[model samples]
Target chain A: MGMMKHLMVRSRRRSLWMMHFCLGGCNGCSIEIMAALTPMYDLERFGILNTGNPKHTDVLLVGGSVNHRNRRTLKNLIDQIPAPRLIVAVGTCALTGGIFNEAYNIIGGANRVVDVDVYVPGCPPKPEAVIDGILSGLDKFEQ
Target chain B: MTVSVIPVGPQHPVFLEPFQLKLVVEDEVVSEALPRFGYVHRGLEALVVSKDFRQMTRVAERICGICSAIHGMTYCRAIEKLLGITPPPRAQMLRLVWSELHRMHSHLLWLGLFAEAMGFESLFMQIFRIRETVMDILEQTTGNRVIISVNVIGGVRRDLDAEGADGIRRALKKVAGDLERIRPVLVDDYSVRKRTEEKGILAKERAYELGAVGPVLRASGISQDIRRTGYGAYGELDFEPVVESGGDCQARCKVRYRELFQSMDLIRSGLDRLSDGEIQTKSKEKPEGEILVRSEQPRGEVVYYIRADGSKHLQRLRIRTPTFANMAALMDLLPGLDLADVPLVTLSLDPCIACTER
Candidate 1:
């Protein structure tokens, strides 16, 4: 147990709190994130709770694309989350700015501001894909 | 009392998308609210310079995923107007059905959010459970759930056969039955009324003068519905605007709740009127003039203005989304509201930031 605490990482893996920051693309992905949390898909069954405050979050689910206006807000959100910060970039826009990449205000995807652990690709990924993407991001805790 | 400025914005538990509202509060009561935009602004209107007119359909649909079908239909209707061609009757009927289905799902989604806004977690899940039925219908019939790419310039890309239409009918009936069981909790439940009634009252005259649209306008006793303009397949269908005169948060809730059934009725009637014909008309000529096309989206009226020069691309494309029209009304209603009431009032406007900022 050198520098990394295996017990704490294992504890965080059991109950992951996700805070979704919609960074200014069409909110299709944000809606899918909610759809994933609700009954039919029920991401909560995996001990995941959708949170609002960055302070309470373990895994940050970033939706849409990164834009000039929201970049500062995105950085502010990332700064608020404590250590062991894991981010899953959901949707094509957040991955590489997708269709809106050519637009004037878009600054590209989430990685432009902060390092994203996992990138889920879709115009707006299905709820299952979002759930899968978040689960896969848990593997990053190994480091 | 000293006033405090609280910014509820680009990311909040209550909001679905990104946008900011600066509340000027004295005590816990809000005195003024200043809105901030550009959080998710992608300059979508400017994309016409890069994307061709024929390709703008995908761009238009992306404006707001909740109302994607109607946005695409409005863009196609505007293009159809410019090209001097009308979509086939069957295409129009299918468009109406999809549009109505979008309305149902959108309302269900909103109702669930409204319940969540009130902290009614169980009700939220219950409504979303019912909403899943509508989503399945959309996916099975149109081949995708949320952003179903069905509309084209001349007509719709998909066709609904007798089997598909029958499945839709059965699904809608189940939705109605589910809704009926859930109705009492939303309608007569004491807590729902306590949180909603008289919370945000926009008088009839104020709503009209401030340019409120959709359920917000109808909730204030105005019986105006753009469907009466006979766009899409509405001309062949018989329906009346669902109006409520309470002019409060509860009134807006009731308006949308009633509309869920109204949309089911509209879809049923459109299915009855579905005739055998081609979905699209062949038009080789490019559009060459200015035209304005309007349609009733789930949120409200969406207007698409297109100017073409007989070339492959358009000269200009402008959209006036309903949320834009409702902003002034929201500003007017927000002052003198309690901090706790802000979420309910804002949700009453059905603020679609993607549509507004785009």
Candidate 2:
């Protein structure tokens, strides 16, 4: 178990391929995630690559809120991702479902569906804040 | 050739948001395409009952990040109409400037994504790098990069000083210059043309019938623009809709590229016409009537329907986003196209699923 923890720690700091899932929120957080991937923020410097496939993803970067319709799909995506995966919930919606939390269809935040490793809060968190949240998630894994 | 079903999205790399497209294919050609919505449906319209009309502007802004400014402006416009109040001349001009800036950023973001769809990595990077300048300017002015909540009921919450206005002018100038260099690349470049030309042809009549808004309609040789409705400061500005004849992916790209320059010109003119005045007014009266307000978003025309019952909260708030109107065109455009062209065609419409579903 100790050796497995050390291996997980080493792998966490390396290239982390992220699969982004948008359950149901505004496009604000999704665009901010895109910005983080682009030249200015360049999240690639931290060895974070945005991938489309859930199976290969080390981190699941979820945008938006989990609603009734997408609950099963969200669970499927989380189930698909390999173990020891970190889920970083971006934006206010992902953290606590933001404005739409009280809506009829919504099932609240990302944590409502699956355990969230980190929550980056903002109407749509800035690219810098998103990166900081990811870094902080990395720190959590180190322990 | 036997037909096989190919599913895309609900979560796909090509789509920045979640929505499914089920493509029925024979050989390599898509026979029929079925789009499934409700992926990003957060029931925002229902929130009107919970939150007051004043707070709904911010909620409306979160409908789509790319067109956030216009969403807020349109919501405010609806409220202003119901209250029978017009924002001060300076506030209107400021709205124009910010709206035009938002348009530029949105078009640039689309261009970058379009380039990515075409598999042009360097061009995508260049477009985004240029887009970052606009984001920076938005951040500096509105204090937030993506969802700038500048719009209030009667007027804007934030005011741009002379120095800030100068900064905007400089940024617009730089963006215009950069766009000038990238113009030929978008419109006439061989590889881009090879991929986009005549790929998804929505004829003029068909586009109108499908209710395609904004660049899609303009690209189909229709000069219909909501700006001509003369809402906000657009009435004061003199400009024509950027039109193209082809109605294909190429034409759509041309229309967006041309509109970028047009938005820059609008901003410059807005800045010139911008007068010194109060940014906002205290609203003593609660909204009492129902008003439907329309604004030209970057993707297309967005209609906001607000029903207020002589109270702080609205009885119903319905938003008809551009994507919701344009999705009908996709049903027409998707079939009979190559499987590989799906992303290009889908993205050409600039589907803001968040706005569409919300």
Candidate 3:
């Protein structure tokens, strides 16, 4: 168990490869996440990078509000990512379908499909907030 | 042997929004492709019929995360015209400032995504880094990074005092400098050029024939920009549309790059010309009549049609976003390309599926 914890910390520090999945939320959260990766916020300093493949990712950042059409796809993506992986629900829409909460098409929030590890709340959270959520996930992984 | 059809997205890694692409492939070469949207549709237009004008601003901005400002601005302009109340000069200037800022950020965001699609991770990171400065300016002036909730019926809601203006100027200069350094990496880099140049070629004649707008059209050598119509304070500014002749992926990339510099210049000019005045004009009376308003969003041109019935609510609001216009060009460009090139080619149009689906 002690060895496993140390390995988690090392992996968290060296590479926090994130895979972003859009459920049904607006593209706002996704853009903000992109902003965080870009120069000004530069989340790369913490070794957080967006990975294209789910199998290689250590964290999953789910944006948008989930809907009926994407439920199965979201589950498949979650299954592809290995265990001990953290799932972050970014933006108010991902948390509770946001303003679209009342819409007939929405499947509520990201949590409805997966057990989210962290919730970063905003109409679309600022880039800084997105970075903070990733860092907080690192803390959880370390424990 | 029969060809197998593989479905990509509605939830796929390459696409950021919900849209399905059904590709019938024969040994990894796409023979037929079909796209379907509306997976995330919320019937926003139907909802707008019931909401008051003020309430609809929130809905309009929600059309797409990247082009929120232009959507809200277009919606407000349509209502303002119906009421026969022009926003104060300062308000117009502020709107232009925010609009261009949004443009810079949006283009940079797309550039980063294009780079990522091409597997150039470093370039993607670099472009995004430059985008952050614009976001900082946005947050400082408008008090929100994304939604910006600044547009009201008559004008903007926030006021940028002299100090705020000076700060914005400095931010713009810094961002412009960063963009200048990164320009070579985007345009002249061997790998980037090879991947983008000559790929997704949409000839000038074809682009015009299909009615493509924004950088996609401008890349094909057409010197058309909605801003040229002088809709905001753009008429007061000295600017020219950035045009490229290639009409390929590289040409489109160049158009966005040049526009980034132009946006910086526009912001500087707007700040210099900004004057003190009422940021918003009060209009309690119902707006009556129909007016069409068009504004250039970061992606391309956005058109809003608003009809007022002398009530707090607009009778009808129709929006035609840039992505909607570019979709035709996308379908035209997609065929005859290698399967590996699909993501890069699709992104060349800078699609905002949220805007398209909305």
What i-RMS does every model get?
Answer: 0.9, 1.0, 2.1
The ten-residue window of minimal lDDT in model 2 chain A covers A134-143
Off by over 4 Å in 3: A1-16, A42-47, A137-143, B1-6, B26-28
Clashing pairs in 2: none
lDDT of 1 at B11: 83
Model 3 agreement with the true structure over B43-152: per-residue lDDT tens digits = 56655556788888888998888888888888888888888889999999999999888888888889888998998988888877777777878899889988887899
Tens digit of per-residue lDDT, candidate 2, span A1-143: 99998887887887689878887988888888888889999988999998889998988889999988888889988999987688999989999989888787888999998999898999889999999988888775676
Which candidate leads in DockQ?
Answer: 1
TM-scores for chain A, candidates in order?
Answer: 0.93, 0.91, 0.92
The candidate that wins on lDDT is: 1
Higher-scoring candidate on lDDT, 1 or 2: 1
TM-score of 3: 0.92
Per-residue lDDT over B95-152 for candidate 1, one digit per residue giving the tens place of the 0 to 100 score: 9999999989899999999999999999999999999999999999998888998999
Give DockQ for candidates 1 onward, in order.
Answer: 0.80, 0.79, 0.51
| Model 3 chain B weakest 10-residue run by lDDT | B41-50
- As a whole number from 0 to 100, the lDDT of residue B105 in candidate 1 is 87
User: Per-residue lDDT of B171-225 in model 2, one digit per residue for the tens?
Assistant: 8888888888887888888888999999999999999998899899999999989
User: Which residue segments of model 2 deviate by more than 4 Å?
Assistant: A1-8, A140-143
After aligning candidate 2 to the native by TM-score, how far in Å is the CA of A117 from where it should be?
Answer: 0.4
User: What are the lDDT figures for the candidates, one per model?
Assistant: 0.91, 0.89, 0.84
